[model samples]
Target: EWQLALELLQRMPELGATADVISYNAAISACEKAGQWQMAVALLARMPKVGLNPNVISYNAAICACERGLQWESVLDLTRQMSAARVAMNTATHTAALMTFSSAGRWQEALSLGPGGSPRAADLGRSCGTLLMECEQRDLLAVEVSLTDRLSAAAREGRELPADLALVLDLSARLRRREQQPQELQGLFQALRRPRPQGGGRTWASLPYQRELQLLRHVLTEAPAGSAAAAAAAVDDFGAELGEAGSWAKFAGGSKAATLLAAVRGARLGDRVLEIGTYCGNSALRLAAALPGVRVTTLELDPLLVAIARSLLAFAGLAASVDVWTGPSKLLLPRLRPLRFSAIFVDRWGSQYDEDLALIQEHELLQQAGGVLVADNVLTTAAASFLWQVAHPPSNSFEGAFTSRMLAVREVAQSSEEDWMSVSVANFQADVFRQAPPIPPELLALQAASERLRERVIRSEAARLEKGAFTEHAKATLSGAGIAPLE
Candidate 1:
């Protein structure tokens, strides 16, 4: 059909008929539907040569074609041309352009377009809603809030809500609640963690951590019981798999992994090490494998990821030597007192690094006899406050606290940009500080809230596993509580 459409447009000159903008628009649309974006652009260009000025319709058709083909640049160029030619863009034009931008991850450009002066609020709302969904999918919570704010402003100006009005209001209410909480409490309750896309009989191949899980499964299946050589070979095969997937830079790999391993080795670690972010259990596996007889305690917030990490550590034959705890680091750190870590690795979210370190000091989790602490992804997360506190401890609170050094290293082997890691050694004696700082009342309240949320999640997950589906009452409870139900 598209070929016939193209042929008919080509033969218009031979048939002695001057093709108008309407004829060109039809052909372009056919090409768009067929995914022949190049042909669509060619036809659009041919119109100008044939003395046919392209109108908004012609341009819209061409933009839609480029969008369908995921040609974001072409869509941008066409939109610019439309502006230059004084072709007023309608809702369709804006929608196509925004969709193209979102598909290409050009979120800034998509946002800059705004809900234009097109009188159709419904159309604009639908497009913005779609964009918000995309942002949530990519875990861009900040961008989601920014876009929601823009849409909320439009609504305040009397624009009607989108079809997904619940999502908008829910996010707005969540944001307002977060704003009222204490600064330290804000991070704990900022957003309800959505379950990853591995539920509802989904294929393992579709999981984001599929490759890591696959590697773990392979190692477990291939390695013989109690054979070091076989274990090493299995690990090598896993590395080869990572190479094939070009993923050495991700999930605690590449230069970052090497640097972390080197720092741990150099620390002259004692009997135990604590890792704040387990994250597939890569660091725990490496530490346990590299240092025999040393115990590794790693914490992860997501229960699903904790399961995966535990599986990976068990597969590596290091489960006996490693512990994977499931909960927020803030809540769990306080419970680790009286048992000191020789070395602590802080590899969680960058925003939480400073708070976790402060908590570590307050709880006396690190050995007073020169224990080492290493923090990762400081530069990438712009954790300037953490860096500053480490380099310049306050005289009143942290005098003679740490001897710290900052290192700039590449995140991956092929990455051009560099990230930073801070390695600090404790310098105070245990007798010098008999009394640790008291936990704030606000922090205690936040910890209690987090525990309640964790219990709810545990109950929900247990119910789902037992019943094979969430009951209507459970769904209602979660919805009323502003938590998204597991898919």
Candidate 2:
């Protein structure tokens, strides 16, 4: 169908009818739906040559194509081109661009765009929540406050807020309140609730992760401490509660937990172990409890989850054995100083597994000779690229042949869904770091442009804040002198 569409457009001139913008748009849309991103982009580029100016619909189709292909840089480029051509972007354009940026973890760029005119609540909430989480994780308090204020104003103007945004805002407010009252552990309960905008039928309390943290807190508070047996018992109790509440699928328990624990126990790890995902600290708790001597360093990108994991770890008496680092694995991996771990567990984004492994090797975070790398949810996450790379290691990337196995496990107890965990051991004869592939010239240019745009946004925000403060001060001074301030 896509081929026929493209052919029809190309033959328009031969058939004595010139291709118009609408014809080109139809071809691009066909290609986009068919997953032919390159063809779609080529058609878009050919528009100018054929004397047809690309409009919002043409650009949106191309952007959608690039987004579907995960061509984040392309999406950025298309949006920039739209701006240069003075094509006013609609909500669809903004939504596609925001999705691409969010998928690529470019939260700053996504936040810079903000909620465009007449945006869908679901799309806007997801983008805002992701950006806010990034800010929280990076300790960007100013940016977080600014974003929440913008969202609050939007809500006041009758914009609907989705459940995700409401949940994140509640958590953000609670965290701020908790920081003010460090001595009060129950500050979240006592903090004055903000008037929530009504739209989504869900509340923060109904969130599964929050419920999991609460259950863990209650169970650990009641259970005895100071030993691995007690911690394991607490985890079991927590799992049982989740099952009763029909939320066990969210937790990494049952067969998945058993397989991960088995991999760790069989790894013969040394004094250090690294975990990439620390959701509720379930796996970290299990690893610490299993090997009391091995110190565990876990990385979690979500600040809320990091706080919950830390709380659960402390309550389970394993806080001393595990250190939870709050940030994405990509940013945190390079910062881990000279501390090589004998075993590394990866349970984060499956698409980043290969890239993170390369980072681990480059930074020498994993012991070269006998390091064990265990990756969870490989099959379900469609991590075929990672599996193939580890199985067929390039000579330059790895020192020696690597041995690995894929173990299938049930995602949840008595559930039909199955997942796989890959456990691999290194057999390096010498220390070597895999050299990262060079970025394409086009991508480098796009990166430079994105950086410039980000700086411009920052400068614009500073000017706006400065102007607002000056206006407020002027009004106060005029009022004190018995003169009405200028409207």
Candidate 3:
């Protein structure tokens, strides 16, 4: 088959058709699959002579061929060319490089790729297994012993290891050791067995987690499973029961409005979920009800609104599953533990989306693989910038970059012509091998200076508000002071 492909490719010029990069790429792919490493390299080298630049795909195929032939040097050389040519290395390229390093007993080089180097976690385990075998090879035993001793000493002193090395240490003991095996691997494994800190000392039980767990168990045990219709009926029954209790608040979007979110989220729940705005607890309840196993943390700026949400949640028997933090998200987000959220829903003020998005990125809050970020009411003028961001996010910003879609819907109770909401759902595609570069020093300095200025302004404004003299300012100046006019 590959021979036929190559013959066709060579005949392109004879057929009066110029061979382009795509044609070359297909030829390279055929060579790679057929284990024709020399042929693949030859074709790759010939591309530049034909006025065609080898892209990442071209490099990836060539690297895979080298990997199959145990040609680590060629793989490394191609990777360097990828950098020089400014080609973006995707997951396939990284995986191929790692496999080549593993096959050549270059365990240290493979370990430098980091835990996120592979797009799929399962593939990462297979790579680790290969690296482990290399480490155990008789020729590399001395280097392995020295590395294990150093890593174990570091672990005993409570020092953090590189992310890839940490993962390797965790998996070392799983492999069968050979005769006369060094004790270093055993020591490293034992050193990492101690329990680590959880949630940076913040309390979750104070939010009454046990009570929520019991309630969730009851709901799940009684609900019929096996189909989507059953789940929807359960949710509808729960919503009706809450409404009958007279605590249901009239919110902008209801069950119908949440259809897009439900469809994207699917049946299984994630470990951690974040809600940017908890208005009257309707959305929070819906999220908790749908994803019963999920841990939800909601942020609300208004104290009165927080209290109302708490009351409504308690009335709906969902107080245990959701935690309500009473403060501006900008202030609270920085204080929360550096835990990655598998899903984040934004229903807050649209103008603050950019600032909040920056904070999320700065803190590394999204899951390292793929996560979901959903925003509501995107049709509003205030949300224009936010919509533009999801629609056209920076390339390779997150592990798996975000791919977004906007769904149009009518307002919950208003006429379609009078009011509307657009829900934007973005699916993140994590490429673990793509590490974001360090932030520039000037950008860091600018952010620090802006933060200092904000603190001073906030102090001055708070003093004026406490003294009840804030209203004396000119109307034009009041707007800048963030003071709302009295009704």
* lDDT (CA) per prediction: 0.63, 0.65, 0.53
The total number of steric clashes, by the backbone 3 Å criterion, in model 1 comes to: 0
| lDDT by residue for model 2 (1-487), tens | 9999988987988999978999999999999999999998999999998788999999999999987888888988898899899897776677677767766768677767765654554344433545555565567777776665665444334334323333334434444434524344333322212333344455545433445445455544556544556655666666666555554334566677787777777775789999998877878988888887899999876554665666556546676789776555666787675888889999864545777887887787877777888888664443444555454433454443356776767655235455567787877644443332343343333334334433554354435344334334433432332223123
Off by over 4 Å in 2: 1-8, 12-121, 124-139, 145-183, 189-248, 265-272, 277-281, 285-340, 348-365, 379-385, 388-401, 406-412, 415-420, 429-487
| Best of the candidates, TM-score | 2
Against the true structure, candidate 2 has what lDDT? 0.65
lDDT of 1 by residue, 28-123 (tens): 899988989999999999988879999988888889999888898998888888878988888877878877876677767776776565545335
Using lDDT as the yardstick, the better of models 1 and 3 is 1
Please tell me which predicted candidate would have the highest lDDT against the true structure: 2
Model with the higher TM-score, candidate 2 or 3: 2
Candidates 1 and 3 compared by TM-score, better number: 1
* Worst lDDT 10-window in candidate 3: 207-216
Sorted by lDDT (best first), the order is 2, 1, 3
TM-score of each: 0.44, 0.57, 0.37
